[model samples]
Target: MGRTTWFDDDGLKKGEWTAEEDRMLVAYINEYGLGDWRAMPKRAGLQRCGKSCRLRWLNYLRPGIKRGKFTPQEEEDIIKFHSLLGNRWAAIAKQMPNRTDNDIKNHWNSCLKKRLFRSGIDPVTHEPVVNVKATSSSTMSSPTLTPSSSTTDSSTSSARLLNRLAAGISSRKHGLDRIKNMILSEPRQAVKEDKLMISSKEDEEEEVNGCFMEIDDNLISTTSLDELLCEPYDMYQSDLGHEIDDQLDLFLEIHSLGQDLS
Candidate 1:
């Protein structure tokens, strides 16, 4: 092959970055603030190409760049936002501070697409697909109900048969109508369910507090109301304890709800 007629003089930096290379780039950028990268190497005394220096600074040395695995909330936010924004990955990444566009893009391809499909939504359209059963039923049900009954002869018999047919169809329509209502109303139903739950919880809290107040009244009758009220003042003085207790109570309630929902 004659080694493809070799030529020697090189200007471009190749291969992976070493620790010393990283340190030098970081230190140079930090100390001098990035000037022209095309001229940065010669100015900063680095043995790297401009492209290499630019990539290192952008992908690694940039301040406020978040690292580590994203939390579930971040993942959800990214999905929801991208669902709205499409592939404005950089804009989506901006909203989720810890996530890069590259990371978000990868997660969308690897994970989010499956999640969307599993949730009954088309990943591309973000719309729910009608199930096969629903489609078939709708098609079959649409016919059977003709506009005129009198046009067919045998007046009495036709009337009775028409009534029966109408009833059967009305019943089927009512059932299918109910199903369609459920399908269309699911999102609203979820909102209403949440509201009802919150209302019920508030009512429960009110009842519990009323009982607690009755107990407190009895305690005050036996002891002193002023002393009991003042007890909490000294109790809240331990800032760490107050924080811990609040967190414990919140976690307990959230844990109960999570278990119930699951």
Candidate 2:
């Protein structure tokens, strides 16, 4: 029944962090930058472990950390953000300034859970509970396109990625195939050809089918996806340039799910 109180060593202080502890920890951090977590305790003359110190500073003692009851608008934003991200508190917290991941998570558990249920909405799925049951019934009676909450979430993420890339490419067009085509414009033909016939060895073929494809043309050294990415293609280039791998990964994931990403 022993707990992970920073470690089993009872020498380190546990439970609540005191005012003096907070003041000392903060003063040390201010005078000298947060150099290393493990070494901070001894340098600051604190009885607390590094992990505890770190969490305390981040969640409670951190400057600019917003406190008090969340406003109505903030509550609505949290619900919308939860629907998209689920339990990714850190991701949800990024949209919100002056808020910690721990704070957002606590608010959801204490306040939003009851609020969603009061509205007859499933807190986990963010869908109407009655509608969920109705959807389930119609799905058995006829064909319902709406998937379960889990599947819907994954599809939502993928769709967002596609839409983001498409928006970067063109304001008007966002058809799935068009975005897929532009994403695969690098070496897509060679990838399709690889499936039918292989000019390269079987061992090397797997590497050919990644974020980018290489045909192993003329054995003039295997070209990398980096090389392909280095070259500019207007359609695929945008503010989303940094997220190319993420875009590619999602595209590849959907392709693996039996969709023709060509």
Candidate 3:
């Protein structure tokens, strides 16, 4: 047998498919039924690559294909599956019987992503966006005074410190929430460090105050609190000392102001 013409060597047509091309593709598929994609375009007498022909038919010309807007349920399903499956568009498409991967992917990029972002949800991670700047600035710049060493101390001192720092600053609530969320979102090691810092009364008051002083020194020396938080910290060290001190000072100032008013 002579060499079979598998595909046309001519430059394949691209961009918008003509009305005539659609009819040709539809007619070819109707009569012959779908076959090998690589040879389909050549056999159908279309100046298109097999891949292009395949996409056109599957995404547009296929029987029972839904071409209108997706339903609300479909939209919810897309978001739900996207959260679980990430950008596996084809896998997400399969969950909706009548949808195509291209349609779902387009919808996500064009509409869903913006919608989620505006709602304060990270569309990719499907989680609330931590306002790191707000948290870092509020915590780093404002120093709160700790109660005098004579005041009651307990294993829960760290927790008390956070509460005191947040006290009397109604506007700082958002920043405090962001910090709590960040701590919760951190790995188990960070969680453990948080507990240790809160519970560790092993150090003498002098040692603890010395450490606080060192952190204050660093905060005074550094220009950017954001950079400091992002830097690597030793597993044993709590990186939030300066922030705590700032909050502590603010707390004490607020208390003294209340006393002065009284």
Better of 1 and 2 by TM-score: 2
Candidate 1: residue 100 lDDT (0-100): 70
Model 1 accuracy (lDDT, Cα): 0.46
Which ranges in model 1 have alpha carbons more than 4 Å from their true place? 1-10, 131-262
Worst window of 10 by summed lDDT in candidate 3: 191-200
Each candidate structure's TM-score, on Cα atoms with residue i matched to residue i, is 0.42, 0.54, 0.48
* Structure candidate 1, residue pairs in collision: none
Q: lDDT for every model?
A: 0.46, 0.53, 0.52
Better of 1 and 3 by lDDT: 3
Give residue 161's lDDT in candidate 1 (0 to 100).
Answer: 25
**Position 203, candidate 2: lDDT:** 20
lDDT of 1 by residue, 140-212 (tens): 4321111122122222131122222222222233343443343244423322221100012123222222212
**Candidate number with the higher lDDT (2 or 3):** 2
Error of 1 at 145 (Å): 32
97-188 per-residue lDDT for model 2 (tens digits): 68899999999989898788667765644544443222333334432221123221111332232332222232123334544454456444
On TM-score, who's better, 1 or 3?
3
